[model samples]
Target chain A: MKSLNLQRVFARNTYLISFILLVIVLGINYIVQNNVFELRVLNNNLRTLLPLILLAVGQSIVVIGGGLDLSVGTLVSMLSALLVTWVTPDSTPDQILLAVVLVCAAGMLAGLVNGLVVAYLRLQPMITTYATSFIFSGIALLLLPRPGGSIPRDLSTFYRSPLLDIPLAFYAIALLLLFWSVLRTTRYAQYLYATGSSGAAAYATGVPVRVVRVTTYVWSGLFAALASLTLMLSTGGASQANIGDDMTLDSIVAVVLGGTRLSGGQGGIAGAIIGVMILRVIRNVIFFAAVPTWSQTLVNALIIIAALAGPGLIRLIRRSIGR
Target chain B: MNAQTLRRYLTPPLIALLLAIALFFAGGLINPDFINVTQAINIVRLAAFLGIISAGQTLVIISGGEGIDLSVGAVVTLAAILTFRITGGDNNLIGVGLLASLSAGFIVGLLNGIGIALLHIPPLVMTLGMTGVVSGTILVVTQGEMLGATPALMSTYIAKPLIFGIPGVILIWVALGVVMWLLMERTTYGKHLFAIGVNRTAARLSGVRVERAVIITYTLAGLLAALGGFMLLGFAQTVLLNLGDPYRFPSIAAVVVGGTMLTGGKGSYWGTMSGALVLTLIDSLLRAMGLAEAYQLIVFGGLLVLLIAVYGRELNLRQ
Candidate 1:
């Protein structure tokens, strides 16, 4: 009985379970590739994963707020296109910074459209976002019909640089966590959870459910822009109109693996971050395990499905045993 | 009928018809030749493909409880590839091709239903994962190069006009629509689906087998998707990796625009047919106006959002 109680506690904390899984995966990764934890290799991996990590954070917020953002991928594509087409290598640093601000603003505006349509119009979030994704991609294609542009080399190289023998990615992650931590303590976070858990109930209790939902999407949009920026820096400012379509599913998968329920309410950004790392590490493991190149996408998807179904399977077994 | 009841039954189909007429006039204005008999035939042909796909989507959505099929496009793609492979472009092997494609769809839907119903996975994640697996399987099988000529009979007889300038494919679509209408409007299964969609616990307590209904709904969706793919092969005369790509979002858009509730249980295949025609007419109008492909997509998305918002308002008011 006591053991079951402990199991219940652990089950209640998805973060704890994800951390343990992350540790196990990292240990296996180390065994497979001795240089797995070496700062140089680690930096390269983290840099590659930075875009998805950022995207997962935005997606986690949406899922926690009882919504989904299928448009994030297209939003990433649109912003990245804007960044590359406008922020030329010869442009002054101030111009580049202005471009960044502009892209972020565009993202928030796009997200605001989604938020208003969803909140005020009470449209289905899933289908509304799916429809809007096409618009975003269309704009992306119009912005950069053909992908050929460069951000400054100095800027790209700086994004790769390490601080104190740890990659800049570590610092960015720390900053993200800090931001989330601060946000968590605010009244908005409590309202977000309440609204997501039960919107009617939240409304009855005098929560600004519509405003809360809209703000969450705006935050999601801003983060999607940031993720696009990361992708731009890593890829040396190249842009593709369809680059972010696949990442939408990847972000949602990370959110789920991080323990956020798709139905909404009950997960944190920290777990989401860990989920992204776990996904990245699993990809690394797949590489070292010599999985055939053509089968990697298939294998990755299968693993995700397994991960998603794993907790439910365990619960089923435990319940049947108890019965 | 009273205004409320009449409005409930008539609003979606009426909206769809009005949208089609508006687009028709717009096409006539854009390119004087676009409203003629030839163009009208062409639009029906185009709408037929989408109509078949939406027939399945309409059912899935009507079953409710956040039911959706993200794997529709992927399933159609796989079905087309397998059918082509099985037939090897021979008219004589058509039976084999159809059987192979239909069975493939059935198995995929059965697996989806199992995961969603028995395993308790959310429908979105379940269908999303199914898309990956099915698409990945196609990739692995084709080794990134899948090419097959559609059978000659498919194009010459099935797709092209064979009877008094009416295409066989259009007839098939009409037949499908009638059958589906009958199934939904005149059957116990249809009643059960709506009941479950409206309230699963109530349906269960009232002796409806929710799980079975959901499973059957998904399986039927898979079969219809595969049928749509087979027709696409006939129309296009070839199968490519991305053939099913355009149909994915449009399938959902068509169903939603047809007046089916995104929340499910209150829609009709007839409404879906008109919705498909509206979208096809819009596409024709866009082409006639000489909009770039990018603008076409933008307009499509924007129009979908507008239509859904209008329908959403009506639903809210009724509630």
Candidate 2:
């Protein structure tokens, strides 16, 4: 009976909502394209959303931990620009590896900077992240101009490579999910959640609130680098400017729709995955709906309003009923 | 109030205006055209649109503790594009254009309000979600194409100066500013709005109908954002996809720069007014320098950080 109840709960869980959206999209795609099985096609698009997914997941974690990562999109853009400008085919395999390592390291450092500013300096999370995003993207643009890149053949293949009709992004995503699962079980995640729920309460209970807050940003930054890496591979390269232009909002939307609270301490990454699926599926719907391309924004606005509204509306109904 | 409290309360807007003046003088030194009558008029006109949006933004932020309306940008974009699309370059359709744009925004705003108020949603996350939804809608509707040709009548306002070099756009802005000030100060509804923002629980205790207050504030923001969209259509002569991009956060920045707290409870329309002009001058100066978008963004970022530091440092030290 307990297992059955758990199954029902998971079935209705927002974290699982995106998976349902994925299934629904595939069903529609199969009917339209007349191919019930095209694992490769699904993998390819998921690959495209991979970097964004990473950013979204990372952002979700931060928000859940009581902060917002407004800079994730810009950070990805900056990293994309940095790698494209610094790494070349002639730079040898070792050089390429070194560049990758450096970029990730730099990303972590940037995240630390943001975390410290928010946790120690006690700045507003959104504003602090927004400022850092601008700075990071500036540095990125200083390195490269426009959106052109020549990512090495090996790097591109690894990101886009098909294994048994499944794209590599799926693997990357699976690995990240595993990591998050482990992280969730650890003391760090517990401390992060406790701190977010109430800093005073957490500190009173002997939690290292400041360190957790700062480290969460570090985690967010590393995730951002990973996101940019996947995007760089898929896009074939990056431009210093506007590389991750859309990632910031997309990630935020995903996190929110996945049932994570932006105010912090009441959400998780699992929901972000589903949020990405719903968002991507919605995009696909726009293509088929034959709406004027410009109308896409209007439709997006409505859907987002709906997504954000739905949860609140449900809660409101429950409260009113209770009253 | 004590001196310390007064200074704490006054820093955000005071610093913002000071920065604007500093940037203006700096720009004037670099290029005198940056401070001419024509330039000043143009900046006012642009700031008017932002003011309208921020007017609504201030109310919402005041009303909810975690409240913010990030959907302002997307709303402006949607309204601007729709106004052009329906008008189809025809002057006769100007009224229709305005109606459609406003209606779209209104409906969207209503949804946002419902989500935030009745549903007990955190306004930031709620609006953030709406941004994607609206942006995706833009992509589908515009399909990478933009519309130009705002009703020439609107353009004439900018072209003709009724006050000896003061463009009609500036006058329209001033008029709107006066009206907003009146609405916020003299009206019972406005008082209620202020009450909710300062203290939600206390306001509710006083029978302020907090939910209604929040809903109306968001709806007001929606209308103002649409108005900004309409103005942009006339101002730019083309409804670019990302034209409204700078408006959203800039309006928030302007409001903050002018004296509004992100945590809500206190803000000034006049401060926001000054804030918008200051931001406009900064950008106009940067554009005059013919710098690339990247450099411009970096400078703006640095400036914002500096202002935050100056203002926030004192506050942080106090707390």
Candidate 3:
């Protein structure tokens, strides 16, 4: 295994490249600032980022199954606003849990609507998700004309606390990756990949393509609900209008960077986690290095292009060598 | 022409525009002044802005290959920003501003074309990515500032009727509609683009420069989008950071609702022209009735669903 081409293995999983990049970027920052791996800064950034990472993971699931759920970002913002506003300051832990469950149920119902529309009415996924974004934002804005919320002291401390001198958010993500990997080996995973890679082929093999496609969205909604909970807690409240706006854009970038094909059927949650980490890390690197805003735009674009270019280059090389 | 062909050509746009008018009048009964002449003139002019943007959107979609420009709004905003910065205070700088705006627009189109055509990137993702870069560039360049103040006298003239009843904007719309019609119906370029869109493999087999067609179509779309942006120079009085934003989705909406197939093969420029006007009327009428922004969105969503139900086949959402 060691001799069977280790570089080839790294080239195949984009997350490894991003992880290496993350290390290099952090190293550069440490060398320059002499922060020497500060836990405080890392925790501070990760708290703001927990919701997005969760959102991206949910998006990755659906994208891998050959569908795009534009509603998850909207769902995150909507559910966060609703849960925060509805869960009053006087609510007990059990009541808060009930409220959280209700939010997840609502998200499930919304996803059910989206799935039915796309499957039964045969609406385009992009348009379907887009229309729901409007519906969700409307409800969100109506619920709170401005940002407001209060997490119980216990919950706030729970999110803010460091478990074993490291951010607890990191631990939750590690657990999520484990769950994602375990699920990857299941029959549902096999069907999902088969469906995304080629729906017609999967259908011929009795994969129940429609059921998997539709169910993926429902589960995505559930994941989004969990994300919203963390997000609201992380922010210590909700903001009016698109609290999760960046998630939609960043999620796509993260999924794509994580080695998932935009066209669908590749990549994993580990890859997506790395993708998010890379983005979050580079942002800090930019600020630390004092890169100008204008140059940063071009640099980010170049990096995204480079990340995508690798797979294309490997394909080109493979074709030449095979011929 | 056969009766079916004639009806097919005329019905969708007619129904769509009529529905919009009906909604506007319904909104008018509630607001009272929405049915008046001044309102009519304003609706027509505003429709022209969306119509120009949709004109470009229609081509990009019609050229097919799943090629849609998400940068339409950003390009327009960038164009607006550049025109303002270059022209600055003097009215004479309008010419220089236009040129500068156009060149910037072309560069955006070039980037989009390279991503989609040369690199074989997915249109939706490529455009989405380009949007981030372009919008970020806008923010970085502008530092969140607006530029260029329009001349008050020119504004009054632009708002007034060019001859007896039609305003300057209506005239531009009419001229654009005619040009688009000719290019689409009577020209070889239009035929070639449609051919490429419907089946690129077949087009390639037939010796069409498929890459060049996709590239040039996107380029043209960009140029036209910039033209729409510059026109706002006189209309909006000053180019703000997001003047181009409102134009983005509405332009695509106009194109889609106007009877263009989303998969790109056959489409109607005249339909898009009416579609643009119809959407503007709905928006303005809603505003007149004192509908809250939230409810306006609700109505907008309902309208889109209603439109799709009526014209599902044309949308190609069936397959």
Candidate 4:
């Protein structure tokens, strides 16, 4: 009975594999770069990784709620563009605060548009977001036709600075986790899981699945906006239209690696955050391991594919062994 | 035909056709050169590449189970680069290049099929991962070097009018469209595909070789994409990194715009063909209007959303 209970615990812990992978990769990174754990280095790494962590967290919410937001990356680009273009280096504190609010609001509005289309129009979430990505990218390009914008030097320094000898990113991530924990306690979280697992069943149970779906997208948009803000601050407010294009796929990869089923209904933000760390550390390992630049993409691709296929391959082997 | 028959048989492609014509005329309004036959043929010629690629996409999508070929763009780039490298701008080695690129495509597709069908990997994830792998391979092989040019004969075949001022590429596209239509409409394989798309378990229960059919579908998609890439090589006359990047989303868009359900089980090559035309017309019209690239992107995306909203709405729960 105890063994069975342990097995159940192992099975139920969706983050187990991701956590293990993160530890292994982090170990490798530390081995290759001995100073990886230094506060300054850690701060620099976390700052670089914060944007994707935020994006993946948002993606996880959507995935858990039975949808996806392909436009999240482009939405990041659009929001970052808006922030940098509107809030100049000389902008007053009030202006900066107002611009930030408006940018985040715009992101939510975009999400609302995606939500309405997917829920009310009953369109495929993937295609809907794919289409909207172009719109977001277009808007980004229009707002920042060239990659030139500046935030105040002080703001960037503040963003990069350690607080109490710990990275500011650590505090930010802790706040995010706190917010998620509070949100997790709500009934909406249960409804989200149920709706994702089986929308028809949830509907039959009077779950208001459509509204749940819409809210998930809204949450995704909100998080994507936050990610954009982090990215903008990290880059010192330089904006490019296609800045976040590559992050979309990477975000999906992180979500999947985090043990979130791409088909939806399982996993959490913690696993996704860990997944982002694994990805970031993997890059560090490659860099420190002195992998040839030309072959880096190849190596990265192979690792991702291997990681993606690992669970299934393991299951297949287990079944064969059982047989 | 009866109204029901007409709606069933004609409405989707008809919408695409009308949109194409309207966009063409709109371009003409901006610049009369757009209305001429030469320009019209030029649009079709350019669209042939996308139309051909979308043919493969149409099949994969119709095979269902969240099927999509995100690797097509990577495959196209791989094929174009491979062809250029193998042929070395020599007409004598053209056949060798074709054979090599198609085989590469086949292998990639076979792996995709196995991963998705046999291993139960989600199609989107599998293909997306494969895109990364293939693109990475491209980078490794080329090492960021630009090399080789399209052979003279190949360029002429793609660009020059052959029969009554019709480009050879257009004829090739027409022939391919016919083949795709017959394959989808007249073959048992097609029936099995549609059945699998609608419901995989039921199709399996009814004796469809679901795995084989799906594997074959993906393989064919790879072949078609490679073919499109080879033709693109001729059209462009040189290989560039990420040569197929631009074609990726547009191929999927063409399929969707052509009224193919993203959920799969229902669509046609002809609809995709017309959808390709519509997209090409939109491009020409935007260029004719002399809009900046940013504005063009905005208009294009907005119009796509508007079009999809009009015809792509899914059936509600009650239905």
Output the number of the TM-score-best candidate.
4
Ranking by DockQ: 4, 1, 2, 3
Every model's DockQ, to 2 decimals? Answer: 0.53, 0.45, 0.31, 0.63
What residue pairs are clashing in model 1? none
Ranking by lDDT: 4, 1, 2, 3
Interface Cα root-mean-square deviation for all models = 2.6, 3.6, 3.5, 1.5
Off by over 4 Å in 1: B1-9, B314-319
TM-score of chain A of each: 0.97, 0.90, 0.89, 0.97
The number of the candidate with the highest DockQ is 4
List model 2 lDDT by residue over A202-265, tens digit each. 8888988878889989989999998887787887774557778777978887887787767777
Clashes of each: 0, 36, 0, 0
Docking class of 2: acceptable
> What is candidate 3's lDDT per residue for B1-319, written digit by digit as tens?
9998877756777877887778777867887777877778778888888888778888998888666777899888888778777767467777787788788878878777867777676676677667767777887777777755654443554556777776776788789999988988898788788889899999889988888888888888888888788777667777776788877767877877777766787777888887897788777876787777878776766666556556644222113
Q: What's candidate 2's DockQ score?
A: 0.45
B258 Cα displacement, candidate 4 (Å)? 1.4
Number of colliding residue pairs in model 3? 0
In terms of DockQ, which candidate is stronger, 1 or 2? 1
State the fnat of candidate 3 relative to the true structure. 0.17
Q: Per-residue lDDT for B20-97 in model 4, tens only? A: 988888788788877999999999999999998888899999999888889999999999999999888999999999
Candidate 3 chain B, poorest ten consecutive residues by summed lDDT: B310-319
For candidate 1, lDDT tens digit of each residue in B232-300? 888887778877878877898888888888777688898899889998998888878888888987997
Model 4 C-alpha lDDT per residue in residues A1-323, reported as the tens digit of each score: 88567657758998998898889888888899999999999999999899999999999999999898889999999999889888888999999999989988998999999999899988778878988888898899999888988898899999999999999999988988998899889999999999899888888888999999999999889989999999989999987988988899889888888888877778899888988887788778888999999888878777777777877787688679879
Which run of 10 residues does model 3 chain A get worst, by summed lDDT? A306-315
